[model samples]
Target: MMAATDALAGVLTQMTGPWPVSAAARELAAAGVPVFPCVPGGKRPLTEHGFHDATTDPGQVEAWWRTHPDANLAVPTGATSGMVVVDVDVHAPTDGYEAFERAYRAGLVSRWAFLVSTPSGGMHAYYPATPDRAQRSWQAARPGVDFRGDGGYILLPPSMVSTNGATVGYRVRQINTGPSATLDSDRLRDFLDPRPTPPPTTSDDVQRSADVSRLATWVAARGEGERNRGLFWAACRLAENGVPAPDALDVLTAAASQSGLGEREITTTVRSAYRTTQPQARPSSTVQGSPRAADGWFARDATVRTSAPGRRLS
Candidate 1:
């Protein structure tokens, strides 16, 4: 198979003017680049399996276009096409160009093979794929930027899309004359949308975590008749106090087992409690800051005196 750059160059040579979608699809396939047909004037794939059905065989390419001659041209991203794209979206009041510009300035997105102007006034920056590892596709919706890599596809030039009641083609904007480089998709995404910093853990948070152990011990000490009901009530308190279902199950499972509860029964009871009370659960922040809120949740059942119940700390 031809390298992606050479194949791209071959496709570019054939794109002198407004070429037909069938011819474009044929040229791409002939260049060793897999091609597929999409809905006319749109990005949605027409084939049953979508991008997975993309093929480089000239015969298959011809059959696809013959059936849907006006269909838009699409190519799979990442290793399938040996290329990846940074899609800069242009939804009104949420344009991604500013975020992209920031990434460019930070040296996070400096090496692009080419640029394509999308019908929606956005841009697509193409890059060579890193051969050593796969880069999965992802989107930073808040920043309005998306990465098209493995498991994603993009429309090619001369393929028109309906935008704002007007039809426009995905036209070539610029070609890189110098060395083209692969993109660090992970770095780019982190730069565009940094994860929030976690709040500092407090003393109360420490107490809350320790309290869970005590609560479990209390559940294990429950007498025969009260075993199931005690487990249910403990699970409900954990849920209302914002303890994640998994953690609650982990702590409660062993304790409930000690009280003769079966594995299935433990899981069912814990899950039921989470489903019933989690929606109305107080936020961790509220529970952590207010001693009364934490105390209130534990006070709901004062019978577990020896090992007092408490809100979960995250």
Candidate 2:
């Protein structure tokens, strides 16, 4: 099994060049491997496709193909043809695993999806076909979800996977059965369609920003020790307002700097808080009239003021 795995890894290294081959190969080598090589049509090449070499044993390559006959050499087509790949790092106890699972399940239901789980517990979700479609799908599924489509997050490929030595690339395996290369129009429609009117925003949503500010103030009052706590709440607040991660990171950084907390500490606290609670939800009113709350915490908080009608913090 190890030899076979190593052989598969080597083949991927030669073909893809060094983005992250081992991780991709691990997906192929998993117990119920979801990996598929896309052949343009349903036809297998007569030769080895020149992917083999002295270091890569021919028998291993043939064996991999034999087991994964659905793997294709053709360029991916249809709606998913231009799909962008987003890499998600699942930092174990963080929101990474849950986020990937939720996104994957959502995609399965939407038919506007493709996802791969890395050996490191991270995930890469791909939207089929068009870049615009992918971006739209991602935007419609932001905050709780992370998308790598255009100008979004960075996708770090496995170390040995590359298009050349410099550019990173992913392996494209064509599906021979189960589904056609054509895009699912319904799925595409959903991808292109605007999100349904959000349930009328509640007071909770509006007060959420204030609640975060209050939390920040509370942390600040506890001396510089709680600075990270303040930044965490701040990031959550900004993220709820549709801010991107980088922007949220910046907000957290600024908040931390002002409060005398380390960036790493702030980042860790925010990520930890994100894992534990839904940041968009309003904070408890118990903290409302506290010392932190008295310091103009709620006054300057935007998230609190924007909560949908009838959902104010109690």
What's the lDDT for all of these models? 0.71, 0.35
lDDT of 2 by residue, 116-200 (tens): 3332333444434442342322321222233332222212123212122343233322111122122333443344333455677
Q: Largest lDDT belongs to which candidate?
A: 1
* Candidate 1 local distance difference test against the native: 0.71
TM per prediction:
0.62, 0.29
* Stretches > 4 Å off in candidate 2: 1-82, 86-119, 125-146, 158-197, 201-233, 236-269, 273-314
Task: For residues 264-313, write the lDDT of model 1, one tens digit per residue.
Answer: 46667777777678755322210101112222321111111111112121
State the local distance difference test value for candidate 2: 0.35
**How far off is residue 313 in model 1, in Å?**
52
**Best model number under TM-score:** 1
Q: List clash counts for every candidate, in order.
A: 0, 42
